[model samples]
Target: MEKYTHLGVYGVLVRDDHILLIQKARGPHKGKWDLPGGSIEFGEEPELTLQREFIEETGLAPITGNIRTAVSYTIIYQYDVNQMEELHHIGIIYDVELLDDQAVLRTDGDGQDSLGAKWIPLETLGLLPLTPFVEMIMEPAVQEESDVGMGTEVEG
Candidate 1:
């Protein structure tokens, strides 16, 4: 088994009972709905990483936000025929506010991990495939419904 860790900056942008989310194009959370943000580059500040990733993933530029909390998760999965990896992912979450909530978002893939960004109704979150990080951010009821079990829970 291989062990690795990832530290990323994420943003939670909620507006009028809806939350902004991006579709993961790769990784353990591929094909799931996840918050906007990603790995911080070397020499890049967390806040700057948040801003850069937010734009890269969502395409709604000219925004501001602040750190809300820090969250972590651990998952072990197989990436190849006989390869197993234990990934410890740490997220620095931010409370982001868009200047133009009504502005159009980039729905196409960002040519990277994001398939696109969309505003998902809070009430409908449970009905969709969500990353563990998103589930941790959701209400208690939704959290309970998530696949958080022994040695398999996604959040810490």
Candidate 2:
């Protein structure tokens, strides 16, 4: 039998010349910089889930741009307080743009949901350590925002 897996949705919200990222205040990569996104519901569309997750996690409502890439990444994440170590997920990352920066910020969950969000310079993205898959998908596109298109080359 195959190991159980979890599906996730992520939006890369960029605004005011900065990208919005959530600080992982708990679990796996705690305190890591990454796009604002989360798991998609059973009957939810990936794009719709992205919009909701972005707002819930970052307090920023955004219009998702073309998919930057669909990346498969592995993580042995521990869920629940028991730390039994059974949960695993391959995250899906997407490209997102914020329509406005004048939005409000609110904490999402009680603990470890990484309710903290911030807008950081686009050029500083390379300075932070991220999941290998995220780094791989974002590197080139970060430098060429104007090049992204339905007709442009993208990886899945």
Q: Over the stretch 1-156, how does candidate 1's per-residue lDDT look in tens digits?
A: 999999999999887767899999988888999999999999999988988998898888767888888999999988678998999999998989788766678889698999999989877998999998898877653443344523446655
Model 2 has a clash total of 0
> Which residue runs does candidate 1 get wrong by more than 4 Å?
140-156
lDDT of 2 by residue, 1-156 (tens): 124566787777665567767777765667676666777898998889888877677666656655666766555555555554544566667777656657675545325456477777766778886655557666765756534533565544
lDDT of each: 0.86, 0.66
Alpha carbon lDDT at 106, candidate 1: 86
State which candidate has the highest lDDT. 1
Pairs with backbone N, CA or C atoms under 3 Å apart (clashes), candidate 2:
none
Evaluated with TM-score, which candidate comes out highest? 1
The candidate 1 region of ten consecutive residues with least summed lDDT is 141-150
How do the predictions measure up, each by TM-score? 0.86, 0.69
